[model samples]
Target: MPPRRLLLRGVLTAALVAVVSPFVHVIDFFYRREAEGVKRQKIANMRDLTPGGFIYFSYPQTGDPKIDNDPFRQFVLIMTEDGQLRVYSRVCVHLWCLPSYIQTRRQLICPCHGSIYREEDGVAIEGPAAYQSYPTNALPMGKIEVDGNGDIWMVGVDGRIGYGREWHNIKPDELVRRV
Candidate 1:
């Protein structure tokens, strides 16, 4: 084989490898990270939510619209009949539609298909949805602690309100810096 032809072939091989290697690494990295866990968001306080009221907020970490595009939103606030705060993700497991808080029905109703979720525990109580409920994907229940000032903080992924402890414990001030 000619020296020039050999050199050209080597160069082409190196270029091809260089381009493909990064893509492969990126794909692998994303999958691996996802499998381990995804950091969705952090909330400063339960006071940010009103009793029987719900609000849509962004995670800010990935800049993915919390409730609009992705499967889940940053948080959902539902003040239970007992007056305790209930926070969870807004994503519906059936078809990813953002469920609305139906005060009359006393549950989160998916406007798309009428899938009803129990606001108390995010369990699917009624409707066409087959799944038990939508996962939290972040914000552990125990981490939702209130300081002496009555400010609350939430941390973790795939957790429910008032379930357990052990959260990422992100401070409100530090949260702003991270974002």
Candidate 2:
């Protein structure tokens, strides 16, 4: 390429970066803040939930009404018959519809598309969600643990939330900040 054209290209690239950098930084900042906030969110007391029972909670409660109050942040905590705890995002992987747990069937069913997920694993076994690829077909899962006081705390979330952060499963000990 000629010197003038090369110079113009470099200048344009630099200008684009300069314009985009701030937005990128702002997004990264928000994502980091949200990730840290979700680290130890107390969902419910283990004693309050019985086998085959479930409850809903939200994560990354950032105190921003728009972001925090969105239904996509909602998750369901289910207590299995063996007393193990499992939490899955209510947002259906198909088209962002909310899935409710059918206790009698032990499945999460999305009414909008009829996508069905197995309660034990959050895997889509039927309908549109089942047709998607891998993790995209499965509901995002939140990791939880019972504290010494028997309070169930959501520690981390696995997979991508609805158009949000791609958070990997984080252990409780790995969280250095509390929100």
TM-score of 1: 0.53
Report the C-alpha lDDT of model 1 over 11-113, residue by residue, as the tens digit. Answer: 9999999988877666575553532225434454556655666555433235435423454434555556665655555666666677777887777777988
lDDT of 2: 0.76
lDDT of 2 at 173: 32
Residue pairs with clashing backbones, model 2: none
- Residue pairs clashing, model 1: 66-73, 137-158, 138-157, 138-158, 139-156
Q: Which stretches of candidate 2 lie over 4 Å from their true place?
A: 1-32, 35-38, 63-66, 163-179
**All models: lDDT?**
0.52, 0.76
lDDT value, residue 97 of candidate 2? 84
Top lDDT model: 2
TM-score of 2: 0.72
In order of listing, the candidates' clash counts read 5, 0
Tens-digit lDDT track of model 2 for 1-179 = 99999999999999999988878666565556555435677888868999999997778666788877677778888987776678888888888888899999989999998999988677789998898877577777776667778888887777676532244534323421223
